[model samples]
Target: MTDAAAPPGEPEAAVTDGPVTERATCLLAPNPSMMTLEGTNTWVLAEPGAREVVVVDPGPLHEEHLARVAATATAGGRTVALTLLTHGHPDHAEGAERFAELTGSVVRARDAALCRGAEPLVAGELLLVDGLRLSVVPAAGHTADSVALLLPADRALLSGDTVLGRGTTVVDHPDGDLGDYLDTLRRLRATVIDDAVRVVLPGHGPVLRDPAGAIDFYLVHRAKRLAQVESAVEAGHRTPAEVVAHVYADVDRALWPVAERSVRAQLEYLTEHGLI
Candidate 1:
């Protein structure tokens, strides 16, 4: 699935899943849907000439998908040194335990509950997976436990659902805070510009080549959505359902339910900031 054949509505891609950088490879999961787009991108990161690799976001509990990911890790006869999760969403970390069993690797995540035989990931912690280096940076907006991994050598960031390869990610309410999300995005944008990031390996969808540009797009998109939500509120859309009807009217109705959740989040943000 090259950029030319990226399917309708999917982001441009030279390839779907393969070697993304010198050390990164994405294995597209079998799951596909409006929410997942193509599928979850299970990333394998290994150092040059290393004998072991790190697997990220093993995706669902589907046995075949887990096996495929393990196969990809061992393609070069290297072992899986560890499994890292971006978040605890079922779509991303549900297979963590199973994948760990398949590879005999420990699972590590920002959430203590998700870790197995390993301590919870710490912000700014540098992880050495068989020789591959990864920095765990706490972004925590899409979900309170959401985190991103940075591979400095590859100039790539593994942005869970905080930033997607295409489109914008929802700031899920309750667990997800819009204010925190904005802060996270600002930090990520600065990281992209300062770190000179060239690639972004998202948990789901095709890879992103222009990290700065993508983050900028997301920032602008969020500002616009916030403005739109403010206007909807000012226009007398008093409830979440009412606001969704106005702000997300252009979106597919099937997604209106999810849109309402985001709308609720926006309303909370606005209210907290004294804008509504």
Candidate 2:
């Protein structure tokens, strides 16, 4: 949520130009909003000789979005075998059920309430849909329900909001904790370092390379922000709003609301640790 320029690493990905008709294609929604985010990236993944398609993040419940996704999958001459959610945020899940209804596909997610035929997706769970394998990785932090899907064949991760192509993600307290978030980053870093992950297809924003570097930068940024918040609190900025003004002075005011949530999380962490 900081206004700081995105740390350099991977090149930006272009929006999907046309219908995704091949094995690996992505369609970016045209609309981008604070809620929708750089438009949810609906990934259509297929494997060699596969007869079905896998849809990652059905995005908002927008009729047009679902229609586009269906059209793209149908163009590939395959039925939508499954719908996967990285997390249960409405932006990412609101349309999952509806999309499943439209495509007659079952939804697989860590949160069953968010998808079809309730199944908890724990880490290291592999799902095979028409020979296209996606490994569920529990990356809780952005939300308690957050998870990332790892496609070993493609060496790609559908990171959802746990990682992003633009700015860093917010850690809303109560459901979002900085400690858990940092742990998730560390785990993701190990995956990146092992060269197991080649690219990140996030819930919002474009795709990115250098998954390890991006996760590292995000961790470092969070540390720096925590320090700044600690310093601000020591320098007489105690309330969340006051800390936001001081610690995030350079960040765009439009995003301060989101920043405030992270700031509150940091404050709780500090208070729990007797740092304030």
Give Cα-based local distance difference scores for all models: 0.84, 0.79
Clash tally for model 1: 1
- Return the TM-score for candidate 1, rounded to 2 decimals: 0.94
| Candidate 1 local lDDT, 17-116, one digit each (tens) | 7888999988888887667777888898999999999999999999999999999898778899889999998989999999999999999999999999
Model 1 accuracy (lDDT, Cα): 0.84
Instruction: Estimate the TM-score of every prediction.
Output: 0.94, 0.93
Candidate 2, residues 1-276, lDDT tens digits: the string is 334556557547554534333356777766687644567777878886677988888888889888988988866577988888888887788888899889998888877677686476768888888888878888988898899887778788878888877778888677888888989999888877674787777777767777877887898898898899999988998799999999888877888888888899999888888988
- Model 1, residue 167: what's the lDDT? 63
lDDT of 1 at 159: 94
Judging by TM-score against the true structure, name the best candidate. 1
- Residue 38, candidate 1: Cα error in Å is 0.5
